[model samples]
Target: MPSILLCPQDTAVFTREYLNGWYSLSAYYASKLTSDLPMLLICPTLFTTIIYIMTSQPDVFARFAMCWGVSLILAIVGHFMGLAFGSTFDLQMAILLVPGLSIPFMIFSGFFIRIHELSAIFRPLCDISFYRYTMEALMQAIYGYDRPDLECHVEFCYFKSPSKLLKELDMLGDLYGHDSGITN
Candidate 1:
């Protein structure tokens, strides 16, 4: 979502391509936005629909809506990135910068790396990641205490309940109690 959809558009809009063009830059961006609308809608709809159905999760519509909401947010972030940065090269640099920024986010996403084990310095950054909220909400929806129990080997017996495992990783939150009208 960083610059994949908007980098070329950014280059076209910010450079001489738009300088000699007839349309205003804002109009150009508007057109660019319109051009991307279909894929944005279609891809997320299909993606979320498929994953929700195939995975057979409870609260199907909620998960679909949450995933779509995240897709839209990330798409908007990418679109604004094109508007904010000056060049495709800068966008590329921003792409590289993303992994550095995102690695901490990913680590704190409560999936791969354990949030409790992380040093305190990264706590603030973890909270800042857009992925954090979505992951939290998704996990809350799919793995709350009331949901089905998980099975594991003797050494992994503690994972019998998803909420227990989440608690062990410091991924549990008050989000479950607050009906967010989407994932939670």
Candidate 2:
């Protein structure tokens, strides 16, 4: 959303500057991207740290790192998506379109419906949905690698077993690398 505002607000200035031969297109793009890098890295790191601590998640460093990494990547992707829409359309249209397009991805993120449960016609959509990959990667980081069972304060905790929860989510596999597009 920040990038969305940036594009519309900067488009006129960029066009004028470019036309006046102040800088080349590549330079302008490079500067814009680099300027956002610090915000991209720092915001996600701080947000992930706060949430990870507040949620009382596992005390494992690897798990925390994975979550933070995924969060940072997601933030960058979302920023670029907004930037694209903002550049392509007017402010109002971009504002409407961002959430309009995001709803489907959210629906197919394996939270509302399992990827396996999705119909064949909609399978392609699930494949393209970053949310699915994000969810899978996060789940793997938090619960996979033979992690131990959760401490259940209540006597009847159904998903104290991470494997069971993963299975129910249709994410019980060595899919962390696949989801993250990184091989071990």
- Single out the weakest 10-residue window by summed lDDT for candidate 2: 175-184
**Residue 126 lDDT (model 2):** 89
lDDT of 1 by residue, 1-184 (tens): 5344466566755666666776677886688679878876787678767777787666656655665666566556545654454243465666666556657677676567656667898778666766666666666656764667765557757688887866875656656333333443
What is the Å distance of residue 92 in model 2 from its true position?
0.8
Which stretches in model 2 have alpha-carbon errors above 4 Å?
Answer: none
Scored by TM-score, the top model is 2
Cα error of candidate 2 at position 75, Å: 0.4
For residue 164, model 2's alpha carbon misses the true position, in angstroms, by 1.0
Model 2: per-residue lDDT, tens digit, 85-119? Answer: 99999998999999999999999887898878878
Residue pairs with colliding backbones in model 1 are none
